[model samples]
Target: MTTTVINHIHETTTATTTTSQTQSPPSPTTTPPHHHKQPPPRDHHCNHHH
Candidate 1:
């Protein structure tokens, strides 16, 4: 009777804790930084006069 109730409580607490831990968001340090897209290369034209 009492033992069964206590066991049920313990199981519920354990399950709640495990769920909360798993659902928690990851830390910032674990995520990668966002980078901007690179610009296209430019063309250069040179004229020589002698």
Candidate 2:
């Protein structure tokens, strides 16, 4: 009986974790580059001459 209860608890916890992972929104760092602008390239010529 104790083992059965433990198994049920383990199953519930696993289901909760899986649900949370799927329901949570993606983080900004994981977002695609197309959603954001690229920074302009630095002027390498000025740096080299200086």
Candidate 3:
């Protein structure tokens, strides 16, 4: 189902953006950090908490 792909993307993108590049962008305009930060607690808390 399409939901499966969306879930996979949500996990992978947030995980990579967080762990792979802590210092990803110095600009506050970049949304990657915001997206990464929000998902850890909402959708991927278990994944990151591990």
Candidate 4:
């Protein structure tokens, strides 16, 4: 019974951690930097296409 309770607590913490991690990455709050990176490649592609 104690073991099961401990296992449940551990599972909950792990699940919450994984859930937070999965949710954290899509924030688009970081997109400005990503867009800075994107323009270089896109302009490179456009220059090459030209």
Candidate 5:
């Protein structure tokens, strides 16, 4: 019974992992090139003013 339960859980975990990998490509949507570059420019301007 214990082994069966473990196997079932493992199978479920593997399925979920595969689903997660498939969904991973959209993660780059959160990272915009302009958004990343904006912060460094702000920091440089702040230091120049100081």
Candidate 6:
């Protein structure tokens, strides 16, 4: 009986820890800055697509 109670407590603690770790990583929102980095314009606009 005592061993069963201890095992249950250990299982609950491990499960809670795993869940907290999984949820923490997704909180940091990643803002991509690469969109602002565009190639420099040429002296003469030669068929500039964009």
User: What would the TM-score be for candidate 2 when compared with the true structure?
Assistant: 0.43
**lDDT per residue as tens, model 6, 1-50:** 99999999999988877876675444422222332343443323454753
Candidate 6 segments whose C-alpha is farther than 4 A from its true place? 24-50
lDDT of each: 0.54, 0.64, 0.74, 0.80, 0.77, 0.59
- List TM-scores for all candidates, in order: 0.44, 0.43, 0.41, 0.44, 0.44, 0.44
Best by lDDT: 4
Pull out the clashing pairs in model 4. Answer: none
Cα lDDT tens digits, model 4, 1-50, are 99999999999989988876776566544665788677787888899999
Q: Report the C-alpha lDDT of model 5 over 1-50, residue by residue, as the tens digit.
A: 99999999999999878876766445544556655767887898899999
How many backbone clashes does every candidate have? 0, 0, 0, 0, 0, 0
For model 6 the TM-score comes to: 0.44
- Report model 5's TM-score to 2 decimal places: 0.44
Give lDDT tens digits, candidate 3, residues 1-50: 89999999999999989865775555553776777677656657687677
Clash pairs, candidate 1, are none
Could you tell me the TM-score of candidate 1?
A: 0.44
lDDT by residue (tens digit), candidate 1, 22-50: 65334322332211222221112222221
Model 4 misses residue 19 by how many Å? 0.4
Please list the residue runs of candidate 3 whose C-alpha ends up more than 4 Å from where it truly belongs after superposition: 23-50
User: What's the true lDDT of residue 14 in model 5?
Assistant: 95
**What is the alpha-carbon lDDT of model 5 when measured against the actual structure?**
0.77
